[model samples]
Target chain A: MNGCMERIYNGLIKENPTFVLMLGMCPTLAVTTSATNGVGMGLSTTVVLVLSNMLISMLRKVIPDSVRMPAFIVVVASFVTIVQFLLQGFVPSLYASLGIYIPLIVVNCIILGRAESYASKNPVLLSIFDGIGMGLGFTVGLTAIGLVREIIGSGKVFGFQLLPLADVAAGKSGYVPVTIFILAPGAFLVLAGLTALQNKVKNNAAKKGKKVREASGCGEGCASCGGCSGKVFPTGNEEE
Target chain B: MVLSENKFMMSSSPHIRSKTTSANIMQIVTAALLPAAAFGVYNFGLPALIMLISTTASAVLTELIYQKLMHKKVTINDFSAVVTGLLLGLNMPSSAPWWMGALGSVFGILVVKQLFGGLGQNIMNPALGARCFLLISFTGQMTTFIYDGVSGPTPLAVLKSGGTVDTMSMLIGKIPGTIGETSVFAIMLGAVILILTGVIDLRIPGTYLATFAVFVGIFGHFQNPDIGFFDPQYITAHLCGGGIMLGAWFMATDYVTSPITKRGQIVYGMLLGILTGLFRLFGGSAEGVSYAIIISNLLVPLIERVTLPKPFGKGGEK
Candidate 1:
């Protein structure tokens, strides 16, 4: 149970597919012009990833090593095709928006990587949880990027008016889109900024962990008098 | 500590030094570009020549000014400014306003190259980056290509407008385009000279042209049923048309932005070719050499990692 929990938590935060691991960048940059498209693509990819992982885990032992990669590709491709057709039929707008990226998801590497690394070795239940966690992490990342791009690129969110563009048109202030945000270059700038932010947060947490260790005096439970090595000095005098 | 000091001094890395400095290389590149410049002048006449000279001079002047302002050594004698200016001039349409061409050159040298730590430190080809900036900023003016006595559409523009250029006119330097890009034969001559002089490796240009030919052949047939499978002549026409030759031979093979290893060069060239073909086919532009080169430049670091050469005498380890 603890192992399963660890796997789930690790995928969600410690090893996020988008922010931390930086996987599936092609689709991340390509289809993230609008929030609606981002969510649509993210959910579709998540569905495919989860289903593929669950099926691969169940059939892991039956698969041979020599033919494993081809077999995994075939399974993933089948799921991708089904999703592609379904989206085309039901959500035609999203289908048009995503365009070639739907076909490209077959080679996304993130889905295939998890299927090979985790699913093939883990139990079906654990694989399923891992898929959910990773998929959600990818979703959060894509949505965050999409929100920033959309709000700035078009001054709209999910195709609805958040900030009043009409007010700007009527000589009012505070509604100007940095049109570059809708273009490809903006995707790189946003991704780099997000990655830098994640690094800063992680570094801060690591520093706090180090300070806590120093204050705890190596956890030795020793009682030495004056000039003892285990003494925890007051905060002001710690630097001395 | 004594042994470490001795070993450091005796280290075998960077074993060779040469009289061939970056300044010398830039000068040679500018010299090699002369054939294309002459051809451009012949095809486009006096205005094109004037624009080219002004662009180059302004680029050099801008670099000097920036260096002076930043309190850095004014290294305009290196001739990189001239190379960038000529490349920028070659990228603009023959009849472009002198001011626009000069502005493009300034952007190339000052903003794209110098602002990013100058010369080798720039991530993308500065000339192409500035060209893309001009294209986006002034689409109407930038795309206005002109031919001899006929101020009209370019071959790519004609194609986009549902027409085809006379193949013979395109082959000769009579078709509409930038000064240097007007003649495929002249560009090839310059490329051959550069290769013979060892200014550039044959790998990048060779792979880039081959890959572009393959894609054009495949896609051209798919689009037009009349054009048979494996249309070699269409591939040639695609190569000769627009900036394909200029980019494949000169711009895409830029040493600073391109990968160093042979394998990485091949991958980078092929990727540039595929992306160029795709953008030409699907995107708004009929010619995508600038965007394609920039995209490939961004991937060079990754390609280097994947194709890194193994150290001698090192066995595989876990």
Candidate 2:
């Protein structure tokens, strides 16, 4: 049970396909222009990923090695087609917005990568967990990027105004939203800024881990070291 | 005196250094650019000179400011800023306001180059990126080209408007267009100098120009059946009318933004030519060279990875 839990945790955080591994960057950069579109696309992709993982695991042994990649692609494409049609029939707004990207998800490396790496080798239950964890990680990443872009780009969240504006009726000032954020170049700028932020976060985490290790006095490869040991030198010790 | 003589030592990664400094290379390139620049000034006059000065100054100023802000050692003395400024000026029309040129230089140096970690780290040509930004932002100002003291449509605009110029007029800069794009003869002369001086590789510009010529020849022939076969004039007019020469020789071959490998350079140049042709034929632009080069610049890294030079004894692995 603990081993299964570890696997699930690993997919969600340590081996996150989007932020940590930098997989599926094309869709992440393309469809993340708006929060609504981002969430819609993320959920749709998650559904496809989970279902495809489940199906692939069920047929893993029956499929041969020579034909495995083609078989996996066929399975993923079928699910993608079904999702594409369902979205078109029901959520036509999202369907229209996502347009070519829905078809593009068939080639998204994350889905195929999960199918080949985890689903084919693991049991059905473990594969399902892997799918759910990875899908949710991707969802979190896309939503975070979408939220930043949509808020700054449009000054609105999910198409609702959060900041009040004075309309300057007699002798007052008014609020006006900057419209540069909605353009294509703004997407590139925001993505670059966010990627830099992710790098900073990862670097900070590494520094903190090093500090924790030093406090425990495990200078070399000591096995029995505990959490706390000596006086903490916080600043210059970052070099060590 | 002979017994007391001392030796000077300099240690660096490159133990064997050449006399070819970055400044020397930049100066040589600028020298090679003189023919085209002089032709541009002759055709466009005082406005071209003003725009050139403003663009170059602004680029240098932006680099200095960015270096100060980023707390890095200042490198404005290297003449890269001058190159960027001159390239930006050449890309724009002479009629562009001084402020527009300044804004372009700011966008080029501060936003594109310094913010991306400066110089060699920049993913796209800073000048070309700024040009695209200005083109998208100030379409009215950017597209208006002047000729013979008459503010009129560019030759590409004439083509788009279903009009044509005599091939002889275009070859001599008589047609309305941006300064550097007025004479194909002058541009070819400058390109030859740069190639001979080893300032740029022949692969990119050579492939790009040849592919572009073929595209225009095949498509232009089909578009205008009234024009006779082997119409050298129409071909010359097409080559000189727009941003083709400037973009093909200077902008597309920007060292930092273009592919490194020879094969990658060929693919990159060919794709850029095809896209430029498509944009000119079907899209809402008379010339698509700037946008085509920028798009290809974005794909250079991917092309480089796919066309990586093979490692010895590592052939069989997928």
Candidate 3:
């Protein structure tokens, strides 16, 4: 039970897929124009991730070592197709807004990465917990970025107007939107800012003598390397 | 034990030293910019003056605070921030709110300049980069120029829409444009000071203007079919109007962003010319000087690599 909770905590904070691992940048940058789109895309990807992880973990013993990649893709694609039809039938607006990105979730590195590194070796229950944690982490990241972009870019949050817009024609002066925050460059800016903020928090925690994992190069869960972050425990001497 | 200072400090070549410092060069450039800034204030009213002051103050304070917090050496005394703020101020519409100028200056100093490594290490002209940032972010505010207490389209905008402009008025600076760019004579006055002080040479600006003129003359007629090919009036209007004059003389010649190699400077200038021409004539905007110079600034590393002069008597590739 403790180990299961640790896996959840690990994915949500220590090795967050969006902020730390930097996986699935395509969907992370795109389809995050608004908070609603972000939440919808995130939850859809979560469903696919959780289901794929469970199936892959169950069939790990039977799958051939040489053809595991193809087998993983087939399983993931099947789950993705189910999620796609459900979304299309119920949430048509979100489906249209997250166009092309829903299908592209098959290639999202976070889902496949978790399947390859965690699920392929872990027990089915542990793998499901890992999927939930990682999925929630990605959802939180996307939601944060989307909230910021929507607020600054259009002065709204989740389709509700938070800032009073200055309508010059109506002579009611208020906040003016910096539209660049919603544009393509805004994604890079916001991502950099959030990443820097996360690093600052980690550094500050490390300074207070807390146990913080440091990434050497790998995404903190490399099955091939036997966990790279465990080897080089940073002494807090090297500052970026 | 008292450590005695060594008489000889070992360093790389270009051993010949000069008294000139980065601060000295920056101060000179700041002085040169005064004429155009003065002209801008005269052309507009108290708002233009306020804009300049606010921007300069914002840029300097941002730099000071950033350096202080980071425990780095404070370089505000060098006057580069002053120059950057002034340049950004000059590029802004006088009608723009003062906070916009302040925001631009903050962005220029903190994000574009300091974040990349202060002074010499920045990837783009900080002023131009911030100006482009503001331009894209607030298109309506940036482009709304006021002349003679009335808001109207600039000479470039008029010419872009196939209307003739008074070249004499544009040359003499009685036109609606950005704070400093309206006055060709003022920019030339500043350019002369730059040349006299040896702060800049004609290589980059000269090539840039000549190529731009040639490009406009050749291709501009196609855009405005009413104007015949190689029309001098059309070409002159382009050269005189908008930010081209200020950009060619000042921003494109930035030491940090422009190419260092002699031959590379020429290529950079030609690239600037073609890009400005393309953006102005073919793109969605009426002016492209700021965008052109910045894009060229990004390519400076490549230009320097290709145009690197062979070291003395190094044999050809074996």
Candidate 4:
């Protein structure tokens, strides 16, 4: 039981899918423009993640190594369709907001990464816990970023005006929000700021003689770090 | 006898320290900038002064607080913060509120400067980076330039609208625009001071102007639909109107951000000129000076690498 708990904790903190492993940054940057969209996207991804991990773990022995990737995609894509229809039926508003991103979650690196790294190698029950933990970690990261962007960018949080101003509610002019938080650049900036905050915490941990894994790169998404073989794809470069 | 004894003073050869410190150099640059900043305050009135002071104070405070929290030496005394603050303030419209100034200064110092490993190690010019940030964040607020009872578009805007601008008003700084950029005369006065002290060289600024002049002389007629190609006064008006003068002399020639070698500086300068021309003529916005310099600043490393000098006396000896 303790071992199972540790697996959960490991995914949540030790290799948080967003901040630590830096997986599934597409939805992490895109749907995180608003708090409600963040929670909705996160939950939908969580459902897909849990079910897919279980299916992948169950079929690990049956699936051949050469066709593992294709097999995994077929399972993931199947789960995504069900989730999409469910969202479209029950929560039409969220489906509308998420738009293409709801379907894009099938390709979220976090889902496939967990299936490949943990599920394919672990027991079915343990893989389920790993999926739950990683999904929650991604949720935490996305919600935090979304909340910040929403409040600063629009002076609202989760559709409620926490910092109420005349401009947002009425047509009158009053407090001007820092609109950058909601813009495209705001996503990159807020993510950078949060990563910087995370690094500061890690550095503090190191000072107390605690073991903390050093993080490298600016976390400006894969586009910036794609060519930086020293940081991102160390294994691929080494093999080459 | 003392001189002879001191000549053998236990140190390596070539032992003379110049009087120039970072603080002193920054001070000289600040002094050179005072005329333009003063003119901005005079022309734009009290709000410009408030914005200038707020930005300078915020920059110094951000540097001090960051260094303090990080357990490093505070370098606010070096006056680079003040220079960055002044330049960023000048880049902004005089109508900007105190918060924009404060935020811009803090962002420039903290994110652009300290996070990139402090003063000398940043990849881009901090002030220009902050200006771009503010421009992106507050497009509506940043673009509004109101003068007295009359609110009008900037000269660049006028040209973009297929209308002509009076060259004298722009040179004399009577136009409604960013606080420090309207006056060609004041910017030139500061540029002269920088040039004479050898703080800035003619290689970059000269090539920037020459290329810009040639480029604008050919294409600037399209900026004003009424004018035909190659009018001398129209070309001068194009040069005098925007932040090009301020950017070419002050921002592009930043010591840490610009290329080191002579040929590299020339290439860098011409690249800036061409990009400015392309953006000014073809881009959506009327002003392209800040964007052009910031983009050129990113290319300095490549320029330096290509212009690296060959090793000394290697060709003859080998």
Candidate 3 clashes between residue pairs 3 or more apart in a chain or in different chains: none
Q: Is candidate 2 or candidate 4 better by TM-score?
A: 4
lDDT of 1 by residue, A1-240 (tens): 133444556666777788888999999998888888888888888889889999998999999988999999999999999999999999998999999999898998779988888887766666776787788778878887888888877789989978865342375756545556778976876777777787877788788874212112322322222222223311111111
Candidate with more favorable, higher TM-score: 1 or 2: 2
- Binned by DockQ into CAPRI classes (incorrect, acceptable, medium, high), candidate 3 is medium
Question: Which residue pairs show collisions in model 4?
Answer: none
User: Which docking category, incorrect, acceptable, medium or high, applies to candidate 1?
Assistant: incorrect
List fnat per candidate, in order.
Answer: 0.00, 0.00, 0.60, 0.60
Q: Cα-based RMSD of the predictions, in order? A: 12.2, 10.1, 5.6, 7.8
What are the lDDT scores of the predictions, listed in order? 0.80, 0.77, 0.89, 0.84
Positional deviation of residue B57's Cα in model 3 after best superposition, in angstroms: 1.0
lDDT of 4 by residue, A1-240 (tens): 233454556666677777878788899888888999889988889999999999998999999999999999999999999999999999999999999999998899999988888788766666776788888888888888899999888889899988856453366756577777898878988888887788788789989998764333333432432332323312211000
Cα deviation of B188, candidate 1, in Å: 1.5
Write out the backbone clash pairs for model 1: none
Q: Residue-wise lDDT of candidate 2 within A123-159, one digit each (tens)?
A: 6655676687778778777777777777766667876
* Predicted structure 4: lDDT: 0.84
The best candidate in terms of lDDT: 3
Q: Tell me the tens digit of each residue's lDDT in model 3 across B62-137.
A: 9999999999999999999999999999999999999999999998899889989999999999999899889988
lDDT of 4 by residue, B136-249 (tens): 878877888888756679998887777778999999999989988989899999999998997898989889988988888788766655677777887788789889999998
Better of 1 and 2 by DockQ: 2
Model 2: CA > 4 A from native: A1-13, A47-90, A100-133, A147-193, A208-240, B1-18, B28-58, B61-73, B94-125, B132-152, B160-162, B166-176, B179-219, B248-284, B291-318
Better of 1 and 4 by TM-score: 4
Per-model tally of clashing residue pairs: 0, 0, 0, 0
